[model samples]
Target: QGTRELVGKVAEALASLPPVTVYEPEYVPKPPVVDTSEPLDIQRLDDGHTWLIQGPWLQRLMANVNFDDYESRMWFDKTLRESGLYQQLEERGIEDGDTVSLDGYEFEYQY
Candidate 1:
């Protein structure tokens, strides 16, 4: 059948079918909250400039960083600086200019 004829036949068939009823769910007041604060691991690499940081929260956070955008990169840096991870890494001998590897991405550590 031609395109227009086929479309018209399909439309007619659909028009003869019963109408659909959409189900609406009730509103939920609040969602259950679970603690996600887990410990992180910092391992020094032999390269002397690279360290591996592993943890669920760190992994999830690192996944959101967009290195190509200056604002996004800056926000990630600021967030790290405000968190305990920065101090912990420093305590673990992470120096300025060192690389921090997380979630398959590498970031430079700066004071």
Candidate 2:
């Protein structure tokens, strides 16, 4: 025998749904981007934006695990430059989302 279901009686018919249903998007709007140069190390990201980023202690624990470098050093360097170390003091600390401003200069970075 075939797998088709037997038809129900007219009394068993289902009710129709409402033609319109209200919907609200769950998305929260993101802040607009104001461009600044910055560096992002998970360490630094953890430092400045603790709420927005992860903790360094956890990152340090994870860093011990080594991975193969399939990428060139230049790639890493480019990322570092964007981190905004150029504006930071030699002794200053930086976090991934932290913006640094120095004498007439500014940049951003992650520790």
Report lDDT per candidate: 0.75, 0.37
Per-model TM-score on C-alpha atoms = 0.58, 0.20
Tens-place lDDT per residue, model 2, 1-111, is: 332342443324443434577799877443223233333232233345322223333233223322343233233334334544334423444446655432222345444
Error of 1 at 111 (Å): 1.5
Question: What is the TM-score of candidate 2?
Answer: 0.20
Measured with C-alpha atoms, the lDDT of residue 8 in candidate 2 is 41
Q: Which number leads on TM-score?
A: 1
Candidate 1 lDDT over 7-109, as tens digits, reads 9999999999999999899763332222236777888889888998888876666666668967666767766666677888888888889998887887677
